[model samples]
Target: MEPLNYLASFIQSAETGSFSAAARRLGLTPAAVSKNVARLEASLGLRLFQRSTRSLTLTSGGERFLHQVGGAFSTVQEAIAGVAKDDGQPAGVLKVGMALAFGREHLLPLLDDFLLRYPGVLPDWHFDNHPVDLVGGGFDAAIGGGIVLSPGVIARELLRTDLLVVASPEYMKGRAMPDHPTELARFDGIVRRSASTGRAKVWTLRHDDGDEGQALLRPRVIFDDPEAMAYAAMRGIGVALLPMPHAARWLKSGALLRLLPRWRGEAGTVSIYYPSKKMLPAKTRAFVDHVVEHFRRPEVAAVFDSGRYR
Candidate 1:
């Protein structure tokens, strides 16, 4: 039996936490994956996994071995792929995770272009509002904001926009325009809450003179989605401090008015994140390059600039 086959099976099973899942990922039967792992254990004279009917756990020895070589085979596969691709094109599944709104609003439209460019590669994407564990979830890359950087993860900033206070003309009607951030209390405030944490967010405004201020008003309406908050602001619900990307069209079309424009709210970034693999797979590498290039394009670059909000 080929040792590499068992090694691949072992790594896949360990990653998925189930032999059946590993089998699905590797295109083998569950029995075959179990048999391969058993053969590996016998060859190494060490039990790697603590298996049970309900769950699977890695023994201490298994953990140590995974730490050493969990990524090694992927690197080897990349080298072989590189050699093969010298005469052909890279082709495979590229799994990605992205935020729900941003993915639908910004990324989905660009898929046709990407597929046209890399016909051999397949795009498999998961869209969600919460952060995803890239490696543990078996994703090749993810695009989202406010993701906590994990050990094997790396992030490249795609765009960062300044947050601004905005409201519809109707919402601002008959309300006095406040000169300072403190005077914002005279109007109704619509604030956004974190979807993951369920905690309401407060705006920290920065002045040009190097002083900062936090919004003192309590939110009359709370939203977990940015689009909803933006729409509410457009419908004269209240003032919202939102990223410029969400309000760009409204602000540009005079649908929304930028209030206290000089006092910008908090800045946030959207980033592309991937595992810090020694030899990134061709599919992963291609998607990352394409996305980075996509953001770097002249048309896309201008809208994401924080300066536009001011």
Candidate 2:
């Protein structure tokens, strides 16, 4: 078998975590998949994986090999697809990474439209609450809220979302509302620990009058998961700063109320980012345009406005 085919089989096996699963995907028998892996391992003289009756795990050597060879294989696939394109229709697998909340709230609805518009494309989606290195992971595109972009990646703003300080209506009932950023010190705060850097995100707020003053409030309760933090806020645990989309439904139902609305905190831009490449495939280009158009709708804008968490 060709080196590329062997590499592909190895990658499939590693990703699926079993020879049978990989064989099913590759249209080969389980024994054939096992033979390919064994041959490849012998040729390289390295133990790629550790296997047992119940589980399979990548060895240190296998991990490194996958990272290097998987990236190369993706590049080859992209090149082949680029040459194979005709009549403005692109054909290839487009891997996308997105934040969990955004993917469910906004992206899920638009996916069908994108696929219908581009029938030649196959999509693989990976969702996480934290940022990921798109190019390193062979992702064609990423949709996320934060503005942080890794080197060699390009970002286009899809929409602007304002951060908000919110608390359960029960929590806000009789207590005096904080009129300024400084007053936030008196309220209990919930913090989202950064999954990328493993640091708690400090809540930053600013006055609306174009004043330069800002407040960085520390959290009384710090959690790694944003959904959990939002749940705690719903239960009236403390005031929390959250993305507008995540906090919107609760705010609309009166379960949570925005605090200090007049004080417009820092505005964050939701953007689609991709690796800066010489030629973007037609499918990727089409999907990017589709997302931009979707977010531009007035009704979509209203959702974020209603859920404004500042």
Candidate 3:
């Protein structure tokens, strides 16, 4: 067997944690897998795995090696699969990372249309609130705001993230409606704190008439998620500053009312992140094009634009 075959055996053994399991995945006998792994270790002069009667675990060297090669190997497999198909059609798992509420509300709705265009692409998506390491996590792409672009990563801007002050009508029954942003401190506030910085988010509200004010909200409840803040506001807990995309549905259904219609909190843009544009995978390219086109639609763009809501 060649060195590539030995590396494959070693990788499979590390992932599956047993020679028998690796053999099953590779369609080889346990002895063959073990022998290939041994050959790999001998060639590198490194002890890769610590084996026992009932356990198989990677050493420090093995962990570092796997970390370096795992994503590269997966890309190679994807390329091979893409080539093996007819006419170089995109075929394979398209791994993506995105925020949960954002993905469901905006992106997932386009899945049917995307699949119709590229039937061979299977979306393997991860939804979390935090940023994901694109290369180390083996993700084809990620979508959200405030993601730091690493050396080899590229981002395509989708739209500006606009936040609005909102609350349930029930919460405002007897309270005085504030005419200025400064009076927002009088209301109970449901605010979001940054998970990374451990500081509460403060937005400077701007109006079309060139007036500006800082929303000094008194925090009655604090959450780490914008969606949670929206939910709390809907239950009449307090006023929440929320992204228009997450608050649109509830606001339309009259479950929540927009406050301070003249002012908006301008956060940074939301974008899609992928590896360098050079030699990008066909599936990822197709997905990125679809997303960019979708957001360009007037109706979809209006939903996220604070100016329209105001």
Candidate 4:
């Protein structure tokens, strides 16, 4: 037997999270699945799984190895199929994960152009406020901000913005504007609840002059979605801590007013994320390139410009 084939078994088990599940998927017994993974680990001189009686989890080296090679084999298959057909046209179900607000306001609008360019590809998009597991969930790509990069991924920044205070003109009509984050507690605050923790987030702010402050807010409205909180601010519910992508149009339209403009919460980068780039399938490659190039154009790029408040 080519011990090399066990590498595929290793990757499949990593994706499924258990030897039993991988065995069911691969039409093998759980014992065979475990043995193959153990052989692959032995061949590599590494411990791949931290095995327990009821579970299997990747070790640190296993995580890094997966990051480097997870989708490579399937991509090689796609490449071979392309060569056989004498074409490199992207054709596959391109699964994408995106944050709800940014996807709707930015990515969704530009997708028609991408589809036109890659007609062979089918887009499968999942938009939400929760975190995404790219490897386990089998997404081809994901787009959004504030994501902590997981074990097997890389992020290429498309845009960055500052989180600032925003409120509808109506909400601020008779109220004094906050000069610092310290004064934010006196006003009605609209804030976010952490999807992972279910607790309201604390605001740590920075001043242009380099002063800093933190606020533990008792929010009048707590939202799990960024766009919803921005909308709530626009409805005069309360002042919101919002990233510029969510606050930009309202600021330009005068529906919302920015307070303490010199002060901002942590700066953020919006990025397109994927697993290793070594041998990406044409569909994944095309969508990634298309989105990057789309944002590089002047008119489209201006909307995501950090200079707006700088």
Best by lDDT: 3
Error of 4 at 149 (Å): 3.4
Per-residue lDDT of model 3, residues 1-310, tens digit only = 3877797788878866789867765668889999999998999999999999999999999999988887787677666657677577776789999999999888999999999989989999999999887754657899998788865689999988878899999999998777778889999999889877898888899877979999989999889988888899989999999988788889888899888998887767889999776437788998999999999898888777666555
Q: In model 3, how large is the Cα lDDT of residue 280?
A: 71
RMSD of 3: 6.5
lDDT tens per residue, model 4, 78-184: 56657854256778688899988788888898888888987888899999766576665667888976666765577888977778888888989888877778888
Per-residue lDDT, model 3, residue 257, is 86
Instruction: Give the distance in Å from residue 227's predicted Cα in candidate 2 to where it truly belongs.
Output: 3.0
Summed backbone clashes in each candidate are 0, 4, 0, 0
> Where in model 2 is the C-alpha error above 4 Å?
1-88, 145-152, 195-197, 212-218, 306-310
Supply the TM-score for candidate 2. 0.67
Q: By lDDT, is 2 or 4 better?
A: 4
Candidates ranked, most accurate by TM-score first: 1, 4, 3, 2
Per-residue accuracy of model 2 over 1-310 as CA lDDT, tens digit each: 3776677679878876778766765667878888888889999999998989887779999999988887677688667766778766866688888988779877999988888888888988998977765654557799886636765568988777667778898888889987777777788888777766788776566556665434455578988766677889999889887777677877788888888776555547779997555436678887888888888888888888833444
State candidate 1's TM-score: 0.84
Off by over 4 Å in 3: 1-82
Q: Where is the poorest 10-residue window by lDDT in model 2?
A: 209-218
lDDT of 2: 0.76
- Candidate 3 residue pairs that clash: none
